[model samples]
Target chain A: MAKPLILVTNDDGITAPGVRTLIHIMKKIGDVIVVAPDSPQSGMGHAITLDSTLYAEKLTIDEESEGIVEYSCSGTPADCVKLALQELMERKPDICVSGINHGSNSSINVIYSGTMSAAIEAGIEGIPAIGFSLCDYKWEADFSQAKEYVQTIVEQALQHGIPKGTVLNVNIPKLTKDELKGIKVCRQARANWKEKFDKRKNPMGKDYYWLTGEFELLDQGEDTDEWALANGYISVVPTQFDLTAHHAVQELNSWNF
Target chain B: MAKPLILVTNDDGITAPGVRTLIHIMKKIGDVIVVAPDSPQSGMGHAITLDSTLYAEKLTIDEESEGIVEYSCSGTPADCVKLALQELMERKPDICVSGINHGSNSSINVIYSGTMSAAIEAGIEGIPAIGFSLCDYKWEADFSQAKEYVQTIVEQALQHGIPKGTVLNVNIPKLTKDELKGIKVCRQARANWKEKFDKRKNPMGKDYYWLTGEFELLDQGEDTDEWALANGYISVVPTQFDLTAHHAVQELNSWNF
Candidate 1:
């Protein structure tokens, strides 16, 4: 049988070490074609470059890698998926995987995540997709700890297809291989950021400030992704792109619009 | 009873006429406080400024608008809401409304909309919220047609709050007052963009590309936001921030993670 075609992408740009690690893992399962942002697109969420133009070019970072085609995109991560599906690939990939991002995209952050947006874009197109993230925010975090675990999950996914209208958001804790426990399928933990801006003046004596915030976890449930990550286990949360509140629909209908 | 407090925000920068119009309309039904992005943050989605410092300051557009306080934040629309709740506002507003944006955020765009993100941010904080958009993408788009309709809807909302965990996403058609039809509450249409990248060469003889896309409407249902807007009727779709696919939970539970 022909190898499963896998589309790989990341919000951390094509040159990031995170995608390189993801590429190494995806290569063991299928033919890989990478289309990722040319620069870091953290916090971009599902932004597409409608007001601006986008560019894509084929490149080879490491020549020794085989059968892995890659293109760096001058657009957001979501734009890369659209370009790959529309213009780059001849046949649709069997699966699409985004990231192994430097920071976590679990819970509420998923809505603001470029990595998960790539996966959601694939799921919208009826393709099975997954997003991987590491809890550590450092550029050169140790992803070797998650190497075997990610490979196992991706292999299992390729062998057994995911359900319709659903994609996976997988986040791994920053732990050594020996300290790492097994994977846990869990729900997104309810969490939010406490925002505070650092006000400052520019060189021109004009007030110009920067945006900053800190994560604040509110949910303490054991079945949450936050709990799993805290317990040294890899967290796998099934994510959906449909923003419709099906449960709230009836209650909303009760209102006189 | 005192008038309901309505928090207003947008991604098209704090100075955009679209948000000004929203403030005007919302003020008639409720006390208004504007907390918006300092610069244009289109397509930011639910992005929060976690890695960087944020700033916000009391803005005084004019002395005539005295009772209504305004603050412009140096962050995404979501960050604006977070700051408003955490460090800016003394207490949670009764309702939150984002945009009267300069473009359409009707279908799949909602997932990537900074306008909707502000409203969703407010919703997650348990505040009733709504995101308003116009089909016109022009800076000088005629908003007179939507004034009466928008006011009516906001007044209705003030009288009867939206359901918990849900926010209204309203899209107005760009038509004259006479041509404008009444409001029609609807569901989000299943739609997507067909992306096209224009490849070109930069100054240094390096290739760069621009991202562009045309909207593709997959669902032709009459009770959809796209259809309503096309027919000159205001579209109101109840949107939710919960990214969880509860139906898929049982199915995923069977998977060997």
Candidate 2:
């Protein structure tokens, strides 16, 4: 029997405590390869480096894990996954896991998430993938609490396999292990950011704006990811890349084109 | 009757002929407001500006349209929409139309499309939206050929109202009006890019790579966007933001997490 080869990547850069904790857990499970951005790419969705050159460097991040390979990429999270699958890895990973991100990627945040984007990228390439996120967003946020839950989800994904044409977006509530309620497989909640621009003037007296927002949950559904997270449960939403609204196809066909 | 306020935007930057053509057509249909990126942002996907200050300035791209308001943003397509809705536009638009893009955003390409991202952003903001793209990628591609179809689709989308939870992903084949078959409502084809990294040594003797890929269509579905485009018809896929694979939620719940 061979250990499953796991590819690890994230949006919080290679040195973030979130990803570092993720790497530690993945090591205990299988062979690990870390190909992640060299800098933070927090809101970088599924962006690929189309107009620029990409640079990836082999780095020795974990000295103790003699078999673990790592690469630092000068691109977005999606780019890292592409570079890893096409150039860095000797073979396709058994599963690609992104994040343990410093903040949540549940609900509408998934649309702007670099963490989920990496996992989705792997899913597009026919690999089973999962994106893990902690509800806390601080640079020094404690990622240690979610380690046990993270390992269990990955193990279960490998055993039962993720549903085809989708990847898991697992967001753990920021709570102590004892306080955590457990895992909940849920649908993405309908919600969006109620954006507020913090207007400010630069030294040159030119007005510039900082994009900030508050999460506004629009759905009251109990089965939604937001509801699960609010109840102290780790939420797993099966996210898809095929953006088609299939239900609308029939109605659209009735329209006069 | 008050004119339908149509918000116009694209990934091809503010001055591209594709958007310019789109603006020309939109002016006839409604009170137009243009908020797009200052430079080409193709393949930027659903990215938003988080770590940087956003700068947007009023611009006069079309002088004759005295009532039309336009702003050029120093950010991604998604950011442009957020700025328009949050800061620039005085009122909520009746509809948001993105692109008249220089290239196709059908099938798997939608996963990496800044054009569709803008439309999807507007949809997330509770506006009826549509993203239009031409199959041609050349800068000077004849956007004029698709003008009639573009106008018709926008008009239809405005009247029909995009399905709840979805926007329209419209792709036009690069054909003269006479050659083009009628529009077809279709599903996104199951497809992905088979990535190839163009590795090279930079002038600094550092290894760099250019990401390239060939579109691999894995689906033989006749009702897919690819099929319609191949047959010289315009393709309209109702695109959703909820990303949740609803069918898979039940199966994932069966996992022992």
State, as a TM-score between 0 and 1, how close model 2 is to the true structure: 0.98
Write down the TM-score of every candidate: 0.91, 0.98
Chain B TM per candidate, please? 0.95, 0.97
**Which regions of candidate 1 deviate over 4 angstroms?**
A63-67, A198-214, B52-67, B178-181, B201-206, B220-222
lDDT of each: 0.84, 0.93
When summed lDDT is taken over every stretch of 10 residues in candidate 1 chain B, the lowest stretch is: B46-55
Q: Weakest 10 consecutive residues, lDDT, candidate 2 chain B? A: B59-68
DockQ of each: 0.53, 0.89
Model 2: per-residue lDDT, tens digit, B1-257? 79999999999999998898899999889899999999999999899999899999997976665667888999999999999999999999999999889999999999899999999999999999999999999999998877878888888888888899999999999888899989999999999999999999989899999998999999999999999999999999999999999999889878887
* Model 2 regions more than 4 Å off: A62-67, B62-67
Docking class of 1: medium
Worst 10 residues of 1 chain A by lDDT: A248-257
